[model samples]
Target chain A: MKTKQELKEILDFIARYATYQLGSGVHTSRAVRNSRRIGEALGVDVQLSSFQKSTVLTVLDPESGEALTRVAAIPALPISFERNSDLSALSWEALDEGLALDEIRRRYRTLVDKPRMDPIFTLAVVGLANASFCRLFGGDWTAVGIVFTATLVGYAVKQRMQAHGVNHFLLFAGSAFVASLCATAALRFDCTAEIALATSPLFLVPGVPLINGVIDIVEGHVLMGVSRLVNAMLLIVCIAAGLSVTLLMVKDSLL
Target chain B: MIVTDMLLDGLFAAVAAIGFGAISDPPMRALPRIALLAAAGHALRFCLMRHAGADIASASFVAALVIGMGSLWLGRGIRCPMTCLYIPALLPMVPGVYAYRTVFSLIMFLQSLDRADGGVRYMQQFFLNATVSLSVIALLAAGATLPIFVFRRRAFSMTRRK
Candidate 1:
């Protein structure tokens, strides 16, 4: 009994919902499931095809045999587990409460608009984490201290460059270069110089994308899986290239 | 002595998880659980490797399984998705050394292409390190997702009101 305009609006909302989930770093399978769940709550059937750069969503009015599809580009958003969790919960809430579209939209807006962790706090914590990574690799206190300072400086640069909308690969490379170069200060001391250099850029390893790629492939979303894996591999290569530059400059002194 | 080492391992891992987990901006309430999962999982891997003579990849798989299960149960309490808890906890166990060695060996292999013996040695090193790194990474993902695969209803419904 829904009008064509109503189906179109639902299609549009589904497109944004799916694309935002994809952009927020969920694997394709989860995005599809959550989107379909929301569609079910709204009394429509949604068929979603997700890609690395975009998603195509089709909303079918089973009662009337009318369908509308929309292709929306997935925006590049920072990973936020809080958003991911809340959005997934929102889908469930819609289903459980039989919530209306307007209520869902209102909740979604509030969820996404929540403030994220401060960049300075995240930077400091990541520096401490990378330093601990050095210790796990058997670095001495001196090397750990070196890595801590190196990561702080490098992550600050990454944060600043990211704010300016730099290419991600270049941002990763620039950060790694700055971090490993700073870590080479261990070469001047009697500490675990190699470990310091090795672990300085550990923070830049694309863990989410790499793991999510495998999850996607295993779950049969092969196209997006391969794209994500390729992207993660490229980032790893960029990190290595950055470190190699530092190593080349300090090769003799390192040994 | 062994207990002390494991304790230190867990302590460092908790700190590492909290720090790295923050990067992805997990819910503030999830931090303590993430730390606990990371500590328990990393410490278990350390114990298995140091005491049980297990290889790195296998130890990681076991540890990741533990983390996966822990996250599944813990996530329900907080009404968060299991991925939000487990992924950051798994970060501390990533094989940084193996990955670095793989890239380093690849570089050496390319550089020594004209020298047959040197090239052969570096090529062998490259494959070995790359295989280990890939296996560990793949295994970690497999182990973590296995719980979800088994308990699909619970995993997907953790955010639902009980």
Candidate 2:
């Protein structure tokens, strides 16, 4: 026999829980599963109608017949697998321990407040990774060196622009243009100039959205799936637009 | 010679996975698992393509299947969802060349629409590249997510406390 206040609190918690997962790049099916798991522990039924921008979640208190529905706009958080994993674990803890909302919320706060990997370190690693990608594509050592330098410069620009709140499409285009333009230095060496150009922008491939979109569609979340795929496609086009500029400049390379 | 190539393939993929996996901010304990998964999947794909005569699409499907199963088992130890482990591992295998070629050829196709023979050649290239890219992408997603459906209870409860 839960009170109305209790029902509302539960509903709010569930909504916040699901929206964070959505924003942090969990697919639709998993978000639903985790939210419902929490709701079940709280002795309520949860239904979510999730879209690209918002999620409409309804909570039914079966005993009191008091239902509450709320729509939460998903935040635009950077994709954090650590956050996603901890949040999912939190849901399981709520279910397994039947923890009260205050305790659950406290744990959630701690998890979210945890510090992320240093951006400088991440940038360095990504530069190295993109260089490895160039090598994997059969670029010569000279081409790899060019790509390494190019990725360092381009990713730095991307990080700075992203921090300044640049639109993502523009960010991607600018980064690709910068990276590929730097990679074109390989042309003078008579080495794998084309391979360097091709691989310089591999770091911006939108892998998560591309894969998550397909998963959502396969799991029957059609609307969100389509929206994600469309977003990824646009980013790919932006990448190509940037590359095309370089291609136009290096027409003789014919890559 | 073949063994050296495969080892190089695995080594590069592991490095790539660690770097890309960092971008997503995964838990520190999960990086090693991501590296191992990427190495195994990418190396196997290399072998299949180089020695077994498998096309990129089919080889990718098999590699992703291996990654899916590996993550299902590995994720439980770390109390993380399989998605966290497999997504970065699969990044190196993305058909970057095919994806870009598709876009490059599409632009070429559109530009040459006035010249019949040129248009025909570009159109053919565009479709060929697009088909390969889309098929590989679709298969990778399907193969990775299939294990979750097959082992629903285990997949969903990987984070559960005993």
Candidate 3:
């Protein structure tokens, strides 16, 4: 059995590693800043070090000049004349007094699952759609209903093609186009009171996250929130690009 | 059928909450346990709302507090920096819907080619509904802190006795 001190050390290491990998995936800068702050606040006394992507380079402590750790985060490819290197911390350690392997595995799994099917995010999208649809066609959800159904179909198509390594930007644009086309067709053809339903999905696109990002900026989490907002807006821009192609192709008299 | 809707909503909310809560910390045994706590919270909130007509925000807060305090009794539950699953999962019931409606309604008015007066009326409608709903959610979240107070007081008293 591992001693209490040994176990804590392992736990601390796992915690730091998990946070590092996940942070790199999302906001790396924020993670780096937060980690540095946490270390300062906790008064952790371990020496910190960094290394360039070469065999003999190491960052020594400013005061002691002792090399802390050797690192090789990025490797160079000798292809193009224009090549660049990225810096990364190879690893760090913390002493968690009571950590377990099973616990680490369990936490890792949960952390991985969050970006997928997170209910609040989905509900937020749905709620915004419901609200906007009701407002636009209050007691008149015809065309929006068509849009909603079309969007679902579009989503289904995207999912199916996803396994074949389809470009996500193109997939999303195609889905939005299909939704818009469905609404447009319903309006021009049967005059079914389903336009609201059809257009509903189009409206569901990144508006909420965009607005949220803006709110985050206003609240001064400028980088953290706005980057999220920008990503959402870019998705919309991709969809709009897809939609404009179809819209411009048709005659002005289609109204 | 109405009961089914309410139950489904609560159940979905619970599943999502527990799942989300387990995200940041204390990975082991968080979901099933958090689910139970969420149920108890909802039940308490339901009773409070029905019998005492407690303010909506206050009711939500009290219920959340119940869940938080009960977590201690459950033994070695997760501790996290942010609100974790509670806020996000609780968000469905957060009156965000009302806030959304408020904005959407105003947009419709602005889009309309009709009388300006009608547009203003919709703008008012959305804002009023949003205010009431948001107020209720905020109050309940606040009231939920009562359990924390009670827990702290009990701890203090016990320490004094010790």
Candidate 4:
């Protein structure tokens, strides 16, 4: 009962939604599956090909066999498991309840537009987490306090740099430098400098990319997997570079 | 004393995972599950290292495997993606010391390039640290993902079921 133009518009929405999901760090298989579910719910057949930064989709009209292909350039977004969960739930609702295109679009908008956790709260928790890591690794109370402060300052710097749109590598390196430098205060106070230094930057490890990269390779998305791995490695190198600056500055005390 | 330390470790790991889950902004309802998974994984790894004398790599592998399977099961039960639980759970096992030592050794190696014997020692340290760090990470990933491959159909059905 849908006209070709109407179908094309629906396909466009599907393509955009899938691209957003992919960019948001859903594993490739899940992205494809979710999109396909959306397509089926709308009475279309969907084909998806995704790379690290872009996705191409084709929506085929079952009755007429005509197809509409759309390509979306997906800008990388910070990983948010809530967004992934909400989007997945949206697709399920569409399929299970036979929701129309307008309703789906409205839900998607609300889901993405939901307010994120406050940046200051995020920084505090990250600091607390890194400090706990220091304790778990055997640091004493002094070291934990130092690491908590170091991560707090470092993460605040990172947030500021990111807000100001600095390059990511610089952000990583700069934050690492500030954090490790602050961690050296433990050495001055006769606390465990090694543990503090080591745990201060724990907040910056690229957990999502590392896990997603392995999952992608295991699931046969070789190119995306490799790309993600390489990206993660680069981030690691940036983190190391940042930490090294601090170590070199305090080599007499640290080494 | 040992039991108390293990409990403390689990507690810290859970706290850290809660922080990570908060940062990632998973659904509010899933935070407790994430903390539980993280604590469980960290406790298992701590026990293996302390009691069984397993190396870091093996201990982390086992812990990650447990967490992975737990994530899949929990995800299904809660109707959320496995990633929502597993990523935060695995964060505590990340080899922070090994990673930092790798970079430190590399820097030491570079600086000692003028001293043949010192350079060799630093180079060996660098290689050792890098290998340990990388291997732990690889093992963690492999162990976490093995269940998905082994139970592919079941995992798929869990995700796909309405």
TM-scores for all candidates? 0.97, 0.97, 0.44, 0.97
In order, candidate lDDTs are 0.91, 0.89, 0.42, 0.87
Model 4 CA deviation exceeding 4 Å by range: B157-162
For model 2 chain A, give the 10-residue run with minimal summed lDDT: A246-255
Tens digits of per-residue lDDT for model 2, B16-101? 88888888888999999999999999999999999999999999999999999999999999998999999999988888777767
Query: What TM-score would candidate 3 get against the native?
Result: 0.44
lDDT of 2 by residue, A100-150 (tens): 889988998999899999999999989888888877778889998999999
List, residue by residue over B1-162, the lDDT tens digit for candidate 4.
988977888999998998867767787778788888899899999999999999999999999999989988888866678777888889988999988888888888888878858678877888898899999999998888888888776665454446
lDDT of 3 by residue, A79-193 (tens): 1100000011111111132223445445545544443333344334443333333333322444434545554555555556655667767876776666555545554645433
Scored by Cα lDDT, where does model 2 land? 0.89
Candidate 4, residues A135-182, lDDT tens digits: the string is 988899999999999999999999999999999999999999999889
Q: Sort by DockQ, best first: what order? A: 1, 2, 4, 3
Q: Is the docking of candidate 1 incorrect, acceptable, medium or high quality?
A: high
> Which is the winner by lDDT between candidate 1 and candidate 4?
1
Prediction 2: B-chain TM-score: 0.95
Q: What is the DockQ score, from 0 to 1, of model 4? A: 0.70
